[model samples]
Each structure stands twice: as structure tokens, then as C-alpha cells.
Target: MIIGTAGHIDHGKTALVGALTGVDTDRLKEEKARGITIDLGFAYLPTPAGTLGFIDVPGHERLVHTMLAGASGIDFALLVVAADDGVMPQTREHFALLDLLGIRQGLVVLTKADLADEGRRAEVEGQIEALLAGTALEGAAVVPVSVVTGEGIEDLRSRLIAAAQGFSARASEGGFRLAVDRSFTLSGAGTVVTGTVLSGRVRVGDTLKVSPSGLSARVRSIHAQNRKAEEARAGDRCALNLAGEGVTHDAITRGDMVLDPALHAPSERIDASLRVLPGEPKPLGAWFPVRLHHASVEVGARLVPLAGDGVAPGGEGPVQLVLERPIAAASGDRYVIRDTSSQRTVGGGRFLDLRAPARKRRTPERLAQLDALMETDPAASVARLLAIDPWHVDLSAFARDHALGEGAAGRLAAELGLVTFSTPGARIGLSPARWELIRAAILAELTRFHDANPDLPGMGAERLRLALAPRLARPVFTEAVKRLAGEGRLALEGAWVRLAGHEVRLTRQDELLWEMIEPRLGGVERFRPPRVRDLAGLTGVAEPEIRRLMKLLGRMGRVDEVAQDHFFRRATVAQMVAMVRQLAEAAPDRQFAAARFRDRIEQDDHSVGRKVAIQILEFFDRHGVTLRRGDLRRINPHRLDLFGAIGEDAVNSGARSSQAETVSPDEGASRQVL
Candidate 1:
């Protein structure tokens, strides 16, 4: 736990820390020489409860930013007011800062009691009580002590110990992040950086990324509170020896983060809910420029109000910070915004969207999205986001936006019964309720398709995906389909997807026509079949009805029409593919002339001749089943995957060959097999 000291200069903050812990926090020679604390310093006190870290902040008004930087990670406030001077301007400002930082636990330290008489001290005490009234520190103990006299020091120590006992353990979620304030090169160690671990843990040999810059490094060693430690967790002040590519003291600096790479990607815009300090001169307007200090970094930002004309003093509203520079941040991070000209803290905010888009930020829909982010309940937030999308949402993005760890996200998702879909590059999710709606939509749509085209097979995968969620990305929809098929709610047959028990059955008239037409197309003369007009005349069916039935058969993958009207059984097409592959393999050059191919087909049916063979070859070319080089054609080699291997029965009988492999319903839908 870190306790940050805040007050006016010359309040004996450094002396008080030294008296309590026996360590001088003023390490800078310049500070000692100038008789003032100009930078942040550190000290520690050990008690039975635990080790308590002390951050001695510079109390001068000019160094309030320095105090803010140190205050970002502190657990409690140590407001020191000099008894001789009572509550001064810097003391009040420092108290305001601690309050703005959302620090709710701390006691008032009234030092230099040796210089004040009882009546004077009582007057100062009165002033201190009035100042702290209605604040988080209201009714907190006010201890008066003098470094020289050492009076009340032990009592103050006991108060600290009591506070530490009640301080809840810090949670180490969302992985490790240390806000760096000091970086330097050690004698033997290449480079060393120090900061308080705000969350997560770090260990030797762990990979860490420097944020806002994204430089990666490895931890060589670690020390907590000036002693060697194998690992450091949240609430511990740690220093790390880092060694990695292009990493050194020169490359390191303050305001950067030593962070877990998995949880971070620095960005400039931050959507947030903010409250303007009650005493601010005016409302925080849209496009107002301010210095935003979050963690250890400060950058110029334009505050764009999302919900109102302006946020009045003590008013709360949604806003987006358009930062001039990126900072390592996540949802729920606290920040203070200082007025541009005066550089005084005007308001504070918590990060809601670390990667907010500049567009549509003012829309009600977008505002509702930001509102969902404001919820403290993880399960509610996850469900809300998933409901906004009908298809699938990126799981990692959702978790990160919610400031939840992978484990937490999983727990929440499980609580809400979300179906997860994973790919090599993304983890996608669908709310169980929403997924039920999509499943029903798919069944309804496919049922309609089957009703309209009862003689045809199921719809193509791409077309079905569009029918389900046209706006959804391909990978997301693909994962959703995979999940659905795994659940036995759908079937992905060849290249089409259909409801669990969907099927196509032909009418009695179609069956009789097919029975008459099937034989003529499968006979030895199959490769060069008669035209549809001749078949209609021979079958005694009208030409129009025969044409429509033949089309239905083609859509069912039962027939291959190579020319305008010439049709062949799909089994005959498979046989032709196997024969071509055999001939190509037998040829010395591994290729066969189109003329030779046509001649071979003609050998089976003299009616086929050259034109039919050319049409088949063109069909193969359009489907990527063959490579054409001038007069010769080379088999695609993977053609068997498209049309399965031919059987001996096909080569031996009038009805030989394996049932034709269902061509992918999408591969050449626009092309007529030829």
C-alpha cells in the first residue's frame, strides 16, 4: 500500500516520514541544497500488518503535477498541515487533489506542534476540521507532532497500522502495469526502472512492453522496498532490471509504463465520464483544451462533451478526451484534467473507451454504448454489447473495452451463456439469446428457399451467411456457422449449410420425367447426349416443362450441361475427369492436347466429337480444375477433390462410376458447367 504526502512546502513532510520510518526520502542533492522538495521521493515503514510504502510528494504549488503523478497509484492520503501556519493555500489545493484522485482513506497530520501553544494549536485544529468537513477525511484523526520533540509520533504510527489492517487487499487483474516515475542505469545492471505496481504481477524473465512507445523488454531482476524479490505484485513499489533489444537508460524515461503486453495497445482518444470540480470558474465546454494527467503521463487534450452544451461545476456528464499523445490506459483508469492556461486541476475522469472513434461520438446510439461501459457489473456490460450485434462480436475487443481480464470475461460470458467462436486471429462471441434468434432466422430463411426450390439442394454457404448476417465479417460468420454445426443445429453439406433435417424431394411429375431422362444421359452415349429439345420430343413432354425440369436437375447436381442444350449425367462428368487425369499421367510431357482429349471422349461416343470435348475443357478451365497452355491442358491435380475417383463399375457398366461428388454449390454458379 502506498500513502502519498500532500501539503504546503515547509510542512516537515520529509522530516515526518524520516521520523516514522528512519529513512530520508529527500534523495536529490538539488532538493537538499535548495532546502525544498522539488521531486517525488520514497520511503517505507515496516509494521506487524505489512510493509507500507510512502510517497513523499513535493508540496510547492508549482510542483502540483509532480504530486499528481505520484498520487495516481497511492492507496491513502497523508495530508500534512503545519500547526504554525494552519491550513494554507497549497494545503487546501493538495487536499482538493487527493479528493479529486478519489482517495477516501487518510488522516490529517498537523506537524510543528513545538512552535504552537495549546490555544494556537486548538485554533489551527478548528480550521483543519472545518476544511475536512463533508470530505472523505471528515472525522479522521488529526495528530499534532514535532520532529524535534518526537511527541505524538508513536500514536500516529498506531493510527497508520490500524488503517493498514483495514485496507482491503489490492486485486491483480488485467495483468501487470507499473507507472514509471524514475529510470536510471545501475552500476552493473544495464537499466533500472521503478514504480508502484497498480495491478497484476511481474517476475524475472517475464516479457514486458514499454507503453505509449510499444518497445518490448525482459525483466532481469526485481526488488521491492529496497530488497530482492522473486516476484512483485500489485500495491508493491518495485524496481526492475530490464534487458532486451534496444533497451537502456537512454531509451527509458518517466511517464512510460512497464506493462503486460497482452492487455495493452496505446491510443490517443479516451471516452469517459467526468465531473467538473465544484469550485471551477466555469463549465467544461466542448473542445476545451486541458492538460490530462493519468497515471504518470500528461498530455494536451481536447475535451469533447458528449451529452450536453457544457458540464457545470459539480455536474457529471459523458465526454471524450482527444489527446495529443497516446498513453497506456484501459477502462476505469482515473485521471485529472488541468485547465490549459492556469494549469490548475479543473476536473477528474475515469477512462471508459481507450480507443473511441472520432465520428458519431455525439449520437444517441453511441452515447448508449458509452453508457453501458459505465456499468460496474461485468456480466451486464458484456451482455449489453453482445445484444447490440445480431451476429458475432470480437471477444478480445469486448473484454478489453470492459477492462476485464480473460478469466473475468470468461466467467461473465459463462454466466450469460454466450457461445464462443475462435479463429487463428480472433475470439468471437454471440449472446445465447441473440444466437437463438439467428438460428431461428436461418431455419426460417432456408425453409423458404426449400419451399420455392424443392427439387434443388440446400443453399450455398456464402449466400446463406448473407441471408443470416450480411453486415457481419466473414471470419465472424464462419465461426458462428462452425458453432452452429457443432451444436447439431445445422449441417454444412459440401459447400452449403441447411437446417438440421432440411431436404429436397421432387414432385411425381419431375420424378417420372427424371426416370425417363436419367437412362438416356447415363447410357454409353452419355458424354454426347441429345439436346433438351430432342429429349422433350422423345419423352413426350413439352419443351418448356422439360427445360425447367432439366434446370432443376442441374441445380440438384444430378446433371452437367456442357453446351446450350446438351446434357450428361454428373457420373459421366466424373468418369471423364478420371480418364483425362490418367491420360495426362501416362503422357511423357504430363499434358494432353485438347484434340487428343476430345478424340478419346469420341472413342466412347462417336456423337461427342470435338465440339463437346472443347466445351467440357472450357468448363474445367473456368472452374480452376485444369490449366490451359496454348493447345495443351494440365489437370489441376486437386481435381479429384472436386470430382471423386472413378470406380471400376463406372468403367465397366452402362451405369458405372461413384455417385458424382457434389460440386461446391458456389464454385461456378454463374457458369453453365461448360
Candidate 2:
């Protein structure tokens, strides 16, 4: 079991722990020399209560942040109130924090009882009882113990064992997360990292990563509760000897943590339950500097009280603490808050959500909703998360918000049927009713796009991407689209897309324009279409109309754009391919140059000479119809016969085509053309 101690400085917190465990928790030289705990210390106590791992924190008012870092993971707390100066300033603050942290199982150890009069001790006990009233410790045992006299030490041990026996063993079978509380260098050893196992289990030789930095480390050795152990489980205080380049004592300071590679990430804002010290003068407001401690973190924060104008001193409220740096903390992690300037212990609380957005306070009701979450039940908390405006969330984001481990949030979502996990493994909001609404909206959008642009088969993927971009935003949105497509709700036709059954149509103008352009393609043997200006001029249609109509035809795949300025009737290109192949085989003497073939077939119809020769030759060449002779026309006989086919097929076949389709093909007829 994990045990933590809370109290004012010099109240025998360290001494009381030493008397109970026989280990001096004060490891610092200054603390020993000055007789005050200056930093966090650790000790272990093995009792019939099983082995209890003790985190001895500095009781100095300035170190309350350090104290908070150690508060949350324990099963119970040892509130060491001093009989000599019962209920000091830090004592009250500590008590308030305990209440806020929800640490219900604890015993009030009124230490230094020997230093107070019997009547004074009774009076302090009464004060302690009143202070703990209505807290988690309201009905807990308040055992008065004097470390010097060993008074109530045995009784305290028995009570601790009994309290611990009530706790079940932690489930160590999950993703691991360990918050580094101490880092030091041992002689002959490189770097030693120590912290309680917050979750999962780590064994010697296992590879681990220092989260936040994602630095890798080899677990050189593992020590559980200060004894060499093969494996360390959740709740075991462990020290790991590490080997890695990026990890160092300075880099792996308190608040930095180790987690399963998959479970590590940084969070910017944290939603938590916050309480102000009852003795404080005012409420905590937006961007107020406060020391925040959670998951071995001792850092200054900019407190942003949520759902309320601000929290009154001694009042409970909801707030978001914006850290100066990102931290590896999650929901349900208890934390302590204090006024750093005054070195005063203020109050502590538990995180309700990590990664709460930073929003300005505009509506009082909105802010109050956040405040109510702090006091809400589990189902209400889940409902609140679901009710967040713009309710879509990444699975990882949801996990961090609830402080649930890997897959835990997913399981919860499934259990509640508040969301659905798509086949692509993305979470999408989909309670049965919610799913129907979203589906209808999606289908309606597709229907509208199809109705508006019937000439095109569907919306372009880019257009769809843009439409969903705002709602999904980066990473998650991309995932959502893929999931939608995978589910067969949409069909992607090239760069264009549409809902599964959307069909293309043509307007009256488009139909007329297509009819005019259809004849310009000549016959099936002539695949090329006229240029945009040529077609528009010939058809008596405007260029803009032709361009828009062309886009529609192209989308339907009925027309093929063979060149940037050239549109081809698909059937015409197919016929040209057949004719070119037939002519190439039939003319053994003449090279099947476009100009030569044009001359032989119908030379006066510059249309045939112009169209078939040039267009078919280019189309054939594009479709792999060219010969490998150094010059193609020189090897043809039939083309040479047109000029002067005086030799055999081999020799005459080398002659160049005479009816080429250049601006002036006749001028170069006598010369060779390849």
C-alpha cells in the first residue's frame, strides 16, 4: 500500500516517520544540519499492514508544492498535527488539501503530544476533529502519538495496518506510467531514477521511455520498496538504473515521468477541483500565479477558474490551471495548490479533466456548468464530456481527459453507447439517435452537391475534404473521412467523389453543346476534337459555356483529354488506333508516315490529309506505334513511290510521306520526315 504524510514543518513529520519505520527520511544535508525537511524524502515501513511505501515530504511552508506532488498516489495519509502548536497555518492548509484531494482513509497523528499539557492536547484534538469534519477523514481515527516517548506508536502501526487491509491490490496489468519524483547519480552508476509505480508494471531489462521527451532507457535494475526485486508493480516505490543518452539527472527532474511508449503525451490545460485556503484573503482568478503539484509535479501555474467568476477563499470551485510547461498528468490525478509568493499552503484538489480548452468567461451559466462537474457523479461527468460543444474528440484526447489508461475510455464509451468506433478504428459520436442526425446531414450535403452540379458525376475529393475540414480539423478529421469512405457510404471516382448512388446529368445547354461538338470529332477513326476557341467558334457557343460543358463531359469519362488543349471522343481514339495498325501492316513499301498515308488515301481532302495523318500519327506514337529505325520515313517504300517509288519494296519503303499536316507540309515533301 502507498502511504503519504501531511503536516506543518518541524512538527515531527520526519521524526514520526522515522520512529515508525526506523529510517531517517531526511536525506538532504541542509535538512539534517538545519533540523528541517527542505525537500521530498522517501522511506519504507514493512508491517503486518504489508509493506507501506512512505513519501516523506517537506513540511516547510515553502515546500507545500513538493508535498502536493506526493499526495495523490497514497492509499491513506498520516496528518501529523503538532500538539505544541496545534493547527498551524500550514496544518489547516494541508487539511483543506486532503479534503479536496478526496483522501478519505487516514489517521490524524497529533505528534509532539509530550510537548503539550494534557488539557492542551485535548483541546487540539477537539480542534482537529472539527477541522476534519465533513472531509474524507470525518470519521477516521485521530491517534495521538509522541515519537520521543513512543506513545501510541504501536497503536498507530496497528491502525495503519487495519486501514491498509481494507484496500484491494492494484491491477498491474495495463499500460505503465511512472512520475519521477527523485533523480540522483550514484558512484560508479550513471543515473538512477526513482518514483512510485503509478500504473502497469516494469521489470528489470524492460525498455521504458521518459515521457514528455520520449527519451528511451534500459531498465538496468529494479528495486521495489528499497529491496532488489525482479519486477515492480503498481504502488511499488522503485528506483531504476537507466542507460540512455537523452536521459540525465537534470533532464529527468521531478514532474517528468516514464510511461509506456503508447501512453505518453503532453497536456496544456487541466480541469480540476480547486479549493482556496479558508484563511486566504481573496478568490483565485484568471491567470493567477499558484504553485500546482500533481504526479510529482512542483511547478507554477496560471489558474483559470472555470464556470465561476473566481473561487472564494475556502470555497470549492472548478478551474483550469494552465501550466508554464506541458506535463504528463491526466484526469483523476489529485493535486495541491498554493500561493507561491506567500509560501503558504493553500488547498488541493483532483483533476477532473486534462486538456480542457482555454476559453474566456462570457456566460455565467457556462462557467457554472464547469463548477458543477467538480461535484458531479461519474455518469454526469461522462455526460458533460459528451455535451461539450463541438462534441467530436480524438480517442487519445478523451483518454487524457478522463485520466483513464489506454483503451479505458474506449471501453467506457462503448459501455455507455455514447459513441461508435468505426471500422478504421476511429471514434465518432454515434448514439443511435445522434448517428441518425449525422447520417442525414451527410446524405443531405451529398444530395445537394449532386443536384447543383448534375453535369459532373460527383463532388471532387478536394471539395469534400474542404467541406469536412472545418468540422474535423487536422489528424482527427482526416481519420474520420477515411472511416466514412471505408464504410461504403461514399464512392470516390478519381479525384471526384459522391454519395454511393449519385448520378451525373446534363442541362439543356450542355446537351446542345455536346451535339455540336460531336460532329467535329469526324468519325470513330478520327479521335481528336477541335481546340476550345475552334469548337466554340464553330458551334456558335460561348467559350465559357464550352469550358464548363467540357468539364462535365470529361467527368463522365465519355470524352478523353489527350492533350492540354485537345479533347478526344473516346470512341474516335479507339478507331484511330485500329486504322493506324492496319495501315502500318498493309504498306510494306512505304513508311506509314502520317503525311505519306494522307497523300495515298485522299490528298485533296486536306481535312483527311490534315486529320488522319497528323492526329493518328501522334496518337499511335503516344500509344507505342513508332519504329526504331534512325529515321522512320526513310525505311518505307510506299511513301517513296508517291515521290518516286522506283525501287523494290525495301528501297521504296524508305521514302518519306509527302502529304504531311504541317502548316506547309508540301514544302518539305521531297525531303525525309521521321
Candidate 3:
């Protein structure tokens, strides 16, 4: 367990730590010259319980930022106050900052007891009690000690061990995210970084991502408390030697974190639940700049209150933090917000969302979601998440990014009966109520599509997805489709999806037109067929409607579209394929003349013209019917079976061909055949 020091500057905080552990914390040259703690120092004390690490923090008013970095990862605190001086300016500020940070364990130590009289020590004790009355340290033990006299030194040690008894190591199950407090190069070690392991575990030879810079490196070695270690778990102060192809010491810095690569999105706006300190002089207005500190990093940010126009002192509400620069943070990170001038701490918050919308952020729907977020339970979170997002949420990211454990998330999902759609590495979930709504919406859209264009096979998949939920992720949509198809509720075509049991059925006028158009494709005009414009003119139907019906027919395999504006019945294309193969030998490089085959088909079918003959030759070219070589076409021996076999006796010639004619229904020619 790591115990941090907090107090005013030169208040014997370093001297008190030295008395207990016999280690000089003030090691820096400037710190010794000034006779003050300029930066954070470390000391380790061994007890039967374990080796307790002490983080002696600087207490100067100007070095509060440095103090915060040390205070972020401590299990308990040692708040020092000189007996003669009582509570000073920085003593109050450091206490407030620790209270804002939610440090629940600590003992108030009144140092310099040898210098102060008994009455002075008693007076200082009263001041400490009043200062901690309502904070996390309320009713905390206060012990007076003198480093010069060694008075109460053993008693302080006993209190520390007692506090250590209650300290439990942080769980080592989440992603390993360590905020780097120091980054430097060693003689042989390429780059080394040291910080307390906030969560998860790290070991030698582990690959970690440094963010929000997006550089990755392999852990060459690890050290815990100056001792070489193969692995270090959460709550252990660690130092890592990193090496990789492009990793350099310059790429890393204090406040940057090395974390699991999965969590790397840098955020500039955060939606958080904030509580303003009650001691503020006035209410905090919206868009007020505050010094944001979390995980050893500090930034300038403007708070836009979402609950009201402004937040009264001591009032807790949801707010949006628009940061001046991006920070790699996630939901549930605890942070302290100090005033921009660094006079004092203003408030502290728990992040609810890393990516918050900049507009309409105070809507009732959004506020309700924040309420659910403050609950800090998985089931409530899932329900609110499903309610707000039309598409499902990526539950893995939802839980991890929200600081919810994977096991708890799984239990809540099972309890809530969430419908899950999954692909490799991702599982997206929706509430049962939301999923039913989605199913209803999809079926309704498909019904509308079938009603409007009954002649079409089905709606395209991409179109159906966009119509249902335009913002839905592609993987989630694909999983939903597969789920529906597996349940036999939907059928998937090549590129179209439709309700099961859906079949193409044309309108009455379309049926009459089909009769007029079908005969044209079956006889001498089979190779050329009839164009859509001619069919519309022949039947007096609109050209657009005719084209729709023709496409519908093509989908149903009633017509083979042979080149542009060319159509043939399935049987006609089949017959022509046979004649071509019959004219060529079964050799691999067999060639046939396009003109000769065109003449033979024209003679056999009694058809005429370039449109019909050329289209037929081109039709054979496509479908591997034959490979075109200028005037000649070669038979693809592999596809000879597609030609089918025909008896020579059945290949009879037609005397006259059908005429391509057009008529108007108003002219009493509704039944005109082309």
C-alpha cells in the first residue's frame, strides 16, 4: 500500500517522514538549498503486514500541481501540521484538495512538538479538528510528534501499521493503465517510465501502448520499489524499461499513460457529474475555466453546467467539460477541478462520458441518461444506453470504457435479457424492448417496399439498413441480418434481403403487357427480343412502368438481357448456345465464325437485321457462350454443357419473322403483338 504525504510547506512533513522511516526525502539539490520539498519524494517502511511505500508530497502553495500528482494513487495520507504554526494557508488547501480527491484514510500528525508548548500543541489540535470536520478525514486521529525528541515516533508507527491493516490492494483485472510521472533514458535501457499501477497488471516483455501519442513499445524489464520484478500488479509503484522499433524517450512525457491499446481514444469534451465546493465565495457560472487534474495530468477546461444555468456552492450536478487540449480519459475517472488562478480547488468530478455532444446537451433525454450514469450499476447503465442510442452499444467497450468490470457486465446483461448481436471481437447489445421496436420497424419498412413495387424481388440490403437506422454500425447491422435470416424470418438474396415467403407478383396491366412481350421473345425475334420503348408503345403503357416490369422479369429468370436494349427468353438463349457448339469441334482451341453463326441463326429463326444478329453474337461472347476474336468466336470447352444438345431434325426453319409494331390503346389496338 502507498501512503502519501499532504501538508503545508516546511511543516516538518519531510522531517516527520524521516523520523518514522529514517530516510531523507529531500534529495534534490534545490530542495536541500531551499530547505523545502520542491518535488515528490519516496521512502519505504517495512512492517510485518508488508513494505509500505511513502510518497512525501511537496506542500508549497505553488507546487500544488506536483502535490496532486503524488496524491492521485495513495491508499492513505499523512497530513503534517507544525504544532507551533497551527493550520496555515497551504494546510487548508492541501486538506481541501485531498477531500476533493476522496482520500478516506489518514492520520493528522502535528510535527515540531519540541518547539511548541503543550498549550500550543493543544491549540493546533483544535484547529485540525475544525478543518477536517466535514471532509473525508472527519474525526481522524491526530498525533503530535517531534523529530528532534523522537516523541510519539513509535506511536505514529503503530497508527500507520493499523491503517495498513485496512488497506487492500487494488484489483488487477482491468486494462493496465499507468500514468507516467517520470520518463527518461538509461545507459542500456532505451526508455524507462515510472508510476503507480492504477489498474491491471504489467510484466517484463509486455507490449503496451503510450497514448494519446499512439506509440507502442515492449516492456524490456520491470522494477517495483527499486527491486527487479518479473511482474507487477495494481497498487505497486512500478518502473518499466521499454524498447521497440520506433519508441523514444522524447515521445513520452509526464501525465501520458501507457495502457492497453484497445483504450486509446483521446477526448476533448467530457460529460461528468461535478460537485462544487461549498466554501466557494460565489456560485460557479457556466463556461468558467478550471484547472483539471486527473491521473497526474492537468489541463485548462471550461465547465458548462448541464443541470442549471449555474451551480450553487456545495451543489452536485452534471456538467460538460470542454477541454483546451485532448486527454486520454474514460468514464469513472475521479478528478479534481481547481480554480484557474491556482488559489484553491473549486470542485471534483467523476467522468460519465468521454465523448459528449457539443449542442443540445441539456435535453431531458440527456439529463435522464446522466442520472442513470450516476447510479454506477451495470443494469441501469445498459437500460439507459439502449434507450438513448437507436443502434445497440458495443457492450465490451461500454463496460470497459465505463469502468464497469467484465464479469459484472456479463451478469447484468443476462439479468436484463439484453439481445446481443456479435461478430469477432465485439458484442453489441440492445434491450428487449428496443430490439422488438427494431424488428417492428424493419418489418414495416419491408412491407412498404413490397406494397409499392410488388414486381421487384426485394429491397437491397444497404438500402434497408439505411432506412431502418442510418447511424447503426455496419457490423451490428450485419449481425442483426444474420440473426433474422437464421430464424427463418428473412431471406437473403445475392444483394437483396426480403421477408420470408415473399414472391414477385405483377399488377393486372403488367400481366397483360407480359403476354404481349413474352411471345415476341419466343419466336424469330427471340435473339433481338423487343426494346422496352417499343413494348411501351405497343401496349400504350408508360416506358418507366414497362422497364420496371422488364427488370422484374429478368430477376425471375424469364428473360436473359443480352447486351443493352436486348432481351431473350431463357429458352431462346439456350437454343442459340447449342447451335454454336454444334458448329465447332470439341477441341480446346476450337474457333467458330461470328458471321457464319449469325447467318445460320438468322436462316434458322427467319430473323433479320444488325440489332438482332449482332446482339446474339455479343450475347454468346458474354456467358462464356463463346470468346469473341473480331469476326470469329472460340468455344470455351469447359462451358460446352451450357450450350445443351439439340437434335438436327428439330432444327426447322421459319418462313416469315414477326413484325416490330407499335399501337395506342385508344386506337383499339391494346392487344397488339410485336
- Whichever of 2 and 3 has more TM-score, that candidate is 3
Query: What TM value does model 1 have?
Result: 0.76
Q: What lDDT, from 0 to 1, does candidate 3 have?
A: 0.77
Worst 10-residue lDDT window, candidate 1: 654-663
State the lDDT of candidate 2 residue by residue for 249-270, as single tens digits. 8778888888776666677677
TM-score for all predictions? 0.76, 0.73, 0.76
The weakest ten consecutive residues by lDDT in model 2 span: 654-663
Angstrom error of the Cα, residue 114, model 3: value is: 1.8
Which residue pairs show collisions in model 3? Answer: none
Tell me the whole-model lDDT of each prediction, alpha carbons only.
0.79, 0.67, 0.77
Off by over 4 Å in 3: 387-391, 403-417, 423-426, 448-456, 459-478, 493-496, 507-530, 533-548, 551-674
Question: Candidate 1 vs candidate 3: which has greater lDDT?
Answer: 1
What's the residue-level lDDT of 82 in candidate 1? 92
Give the C-alpha miss distance for residue 545 in model 3, angstroms: 9.3
| lDDT of each residue in 1-674, candidate 3, tens digit only | 88898988888989888988989989899999989998878888889777788889998888999999889888888889998888999998888878777788888998988999878888899999999997788899998898999999999999888777877788887778888888889996678988888888888877888978889889999988667899987888888999987777788888898877777778889999888888888877789889999988899999999987888899988999999988877687789999999878888979988878899899987887777677666567767767784446677777667544335445445655666654567667777666667677777888899888776777877788889853466776666666566666666643467788788877787788898878866655666666877777777888888778777787755666777656677677667777777767643567776566777787766655655677777766776767877777877764543323332122111101211122223334223221
